[model samples]
Target: FGKSANKFLQKCGVKNEPPAVKIAELLVKSSREVWESVGRDTENYKFILQKLADDFNNIEENPDLITRMKAEPILLGVSEGKKYDLDSVENIYINDDVVYLEIYNELSMIPKGYSKFLYECLGCKSLSESIKEKVEVSGNTQETKESQDLQKKLDERAYLFYCDYPKNFIRRNEGWLKKLKVKGIDKIEAKYFMKAKNNYKIRPVTACILEDQEKCIFNFYITLKPDYLDISKCLVMYIYKSRKSREINYLAMMLKAPLEDLKYSNNDANQENSQCGVDKTEYDPQIDQNSTNYDSQLEDLFKSLRTMFEDCDHDYIYHCLKQQEEDKLINVENHLMEGNYPKIKIPVNPYDPPVTIKVGKTFMNVIQISQPSLGSYLNENQTIYCKNIKDYSLKFEKFLDGIEFHIPKDIDKSEIFSRHQNSLNHFAKIIKDLIEVFDCAPKFIRIFYDKSNLMAFNQDRALFFNFKIYLDLYKIEPTIDAMTYWYMVICHELAHKFVNDHNSEHEVSIS
Candidate 1:
């Protein structure tokens, strides 16, 4: 029978077969012969006969066995109990219905060949048939359909394992069966194994086996260490199927996890951890320590400015300016020379001008005395003055051409300008409130509209506002209230006047 089987295999082009196939073929045939001699009664030898019959039936019925052998034959002989060197086998034949497999123990290298005829005799469902069955199943629930898809993946993987790692499969199976103390090979039921101890600080690891009528699913559960606040858990499942006619028909693996949980866990973890090694505690200490000093200084400055504004007596100044307009007292120098008005000293940068508040018979003039040099100062006082009090008030207006503006094209130019103006007015109100309530203003305050930059500073004396920057800002953030942006910028610039340290890293903090 061995010779005939060999001849048949050679004829069918199944050469270089692995030792496992040869041993399995021999075992099937031997079991059949032994069973026939014992009158085929399974009651007396239930385990051994049943196992042998199963192996025999598998070899006889598996349709892909021959194709599998021809493609890649499985190697054997890594089992624990016995050592069988296939290389030593010399002759294999059948005599008197009993097979003879001869091995030369003295041979240094193991021989390699298996009976293709036996391999061909084994039967399994064709790949097309398996695929057809999978396609035919319908009318399943969403969950059932998902499980079916997973099963298909498992099948493909299992097939690859049977084709590539036959020896490993046998070894693993042997070990698995030994753990159960089973005397003969058969299907193993699915089971679950979880870690004996659960620790929340560390990720958990678990495993389970699920068995259906046709397939066995092995699952491994593991939790991923969180990089941030969110933690993730993964389930890797391996699918395996064994046929009555073939020990294994398919093997595959798939992974599943809760993505949202993982995402949130990571985020939460990140927030709890220190940012760039800077602790929150450290930040609080510094802020608390400097807050008092900053508050007192700001309070003192506001109080002094408020007192000065009150001293100026705005209502009286307005009345005097109105009278001057009616009287047409346009020549400020003539009025100053007449000496009919009360002269009040106004604080300003001495380098620029010496500001003087003058009240005439029917007018009030805030004059700046410009001198070319200290010698000229000793000689005369030439006046440059603002006769109208309205001219001294801060104004925010459109300073840039709408066409050159780089804001969103979709927004109307007029609308953007309006928002920009509104922002400035809102900020101006905040400044006024601060000055009135806190009783403070910069010693020499002046505001100008210019196209050169968003804002320019000359100590606290001069502030230049540009329309383009604020318009662009409003365009970029339409949702943000214009007043909020303006308030922040004004406060920031005002804070700079107080600190005056361009290099200070805590400038923003102080502000």
Candidate 2:
């Protein structure tokens, strides 16, 4: 796996990323989100960070840690519209965006670019925002009180963690920062640029692309020493071309030193966490451990791992096993089938008659059908058809061309602009709402089909790519329950575009 990781990195155009120097410890303020109003003091970021880093003890063995975050029910913030979680906060890492930690009514600077690097990169994204905001805004003190002390402690420590030695330390003075230029080479090359700031305390200036690539990407931890003579302290982030898109859609930061360099040099004082008070005490400001049963908890964890893999109670060898029998997981014919599926029934009038439908309390004539069904045609759904999609409702049909990207000629417009257009129009309007509420637009939307299964999207629920989403229906069902289900599924899959796994982050994003 390690060898494969190096090979993968090479494919992504990463090079020469070796282990570097370390500092003994940096003192930083800590906050705890709990009910008790006990005062907290600053502690060593190394001690606390290593504790948080321990949460990813399995990362060294994980080949994909750089791409997807291993969610651990890490909390987020609560808001009137949606609750925050690790998943929603990916922008801080992937996009140059800031989500600051509010401390004691004193706003801590979480410059947009550094916010994300400190988040998943440092495992600090789960830290609560502010104690007071949760209480006053949501009127929910119970949840906030439970984490008040811990939140407060983590808040100060988190602020110090990100700001202490954050990324893009570009403080050019006396020609201090060098370009490291070579023939036909540039470290900060890009066709597009997003605003970024330096975490340098003094003489900080906007640094151009730290390690530019063939394409543009916002993921760079751009670490530099205080003197800023082309030296690095932490893993320097690099841009990677997405294997699928062949463009800079993915970002990767060096996780840790290579396995061969696991042993930190004797001079690396702060690399190894001090056992000053790991399991011996609770809330010892001098110690890193927060709970007394830390050891027992770790023991249980190890035991669970053993049982899960070594003991064979779980299916660790699923890929190795050969399954000759039919699948026992589910039966789509009976178990997965739904009712009220055919939303539009054929009208008994073969002559088409004078068809009148009510749209929002106003009745309208059925203008013209594509191919006469019982005289009136059915749309792509084979339910009902109309002469022009615009006839259903201008409010819904407007979204087709309103999207940011041009609709590719290959995209089957039949579904979105067919006889059952009223339903499609309604869905288009919902997409518009999503765009307005989220302040972003879909690149384009297309409809596709899959005959092998009942579900087809990423999770076999709906199709999501780039910024568009669509679903191919075996039949159109206009029931409220079915419509609402599709709505939730669409939103749920959209959240996965940031955080792939379903966890607390995904939940808050949906909310």
Candidate 3:
């Protein structure tokens, strides 16, 4: 175990523990805490804890794995003064510049005020440069090198911050120009120009120039759609001029051909006729081919531009212009969950039809069932079985009559029928007790016995207990109790109704 494991176990109430027992105790305590917090039985938690324990032991033996584990921050689920599940934390990596952490899933178990903790665990400011150096010295293949190059370009081009466009604009020269300031840039000048003939709009162009120290740094031209509703479809042309050559070159052109037609037609005397006759060429075959090739190259340039600016935050420009105020701005955090436990509001009436509500950070519908009846098998013999059980033995009479259970005798030929009945009654009582402990009882408890060799399942507010496998096993094995198994299955399924997560691991832990 490393310093992180030691610190976590201490936080989880496992202080003064031997070094050999520290890791095991941490896994067990954390998992048990998580299970209890979610109002679930800790049966399934053992599997996850055992796996983590094995991994921890393996890492201790392997020097390289131990080093990697130490470098990465352990994500712990903290609730009610206890930590649970160290493996639940996603691995965060620092980029080459070390300016930000690359968090893959933002909804991961990174607690608030843990940024400093992560930095401490990482130990070094930057690991990206070392990783890159390793790859280079080891001789990366062509595909790996190409991918690295592309990623480098993307990283270099990525913007640090984005803003929305201003709301107010006065249309001049059939268009308008809006000047805005970027954080690092000294001056950014923008213009929107339109070309119209015979009351028909021909060209809608947006141009921007960025300057620093009286020298132009970037020039951009965007050709908007005729309606201009879909900003995603707009064509953008970025021009770059080299300082050494004093020559201008196109950096990229997004959605190019449509804009090219407007560009060529705008220069012609008769815009409508020239645009219509763009494909037509003079009778010299070789000259016509050469001209066609040049046009093809221009279209290729536009396509290339799309790739260059594919990940660029164009939405920022639209947002900046539309909002026009800093206070009204919205970011990715507005749409994502920022806390450990999602804020869940359970209605006063548990039996009411599930209503759509915000759970955690996201909005979702939760289905609640009140007084759910057990399946047909148990319901069919409810009156007859209750009467017979009362007459058969006074010992079983103490159990609540609210729950009805049916166990098929054919499940195990050697087991007595009365024993099966007694075990089921005991199981139902345990479930009720567990529910009372958690204070999350449903409207009703229903148990159905089936010989399909299936596991017990809880669905749509009802529990179907398989008599063939689960019931028979509980009778045969003293270690396997009906109460614990039933509680585990019920809690597991109830969590699904609450959060609706499809993840098996999460479902297992909750169960």
Q: Tens digit of lDDT per residue, candidate 3, span 135-200?
A: 001111123332333234223322210001011321111111112221111222222211211121
For candidate 3, the TM-score is: 0.21
Q: Over the stretch 1-511, how does candidate 2's per-residue lDDT look in tens digits?
A: 2333243334334443311111101111112221012222112222222333333344434444323333321212223233322222322222111111211112222221111222444343222221111100111113222123322322222222222121222222111122222111112211211123212121221112233366432222121211111111111111111011101111011112232443433234233323221111111111111101122223333334333343221111121111112231222112112221111122232112243343331101111111111111224552422121121111212334354222334455565456545554455544444433333344323232212122212322223221122333414544444434444554554544435445799677555
Per TM-score, the best of the predicted structures is 3
What alpha-carbon RMSD in Å does predicted model 3 have with respect to the real structure? Answer: 25.1
Error of 2 at 95 (Å): 68
TM-scores for all predictions: 0.17, 0.17, 0.21
**Model 1, TM vs. native:** 0.17
Whole-model alpha-carbon lDDT for candidate 1: 0.28
Give the runs in model 2 whose Cα sits over 4 Å from its true position: 1-401, 404-420, 442-483, 503-511
Where does model 1 exceed 4 Å of error? Answer: 1-427, 430-447, 459-464, 476-481, 498-501, 505-511
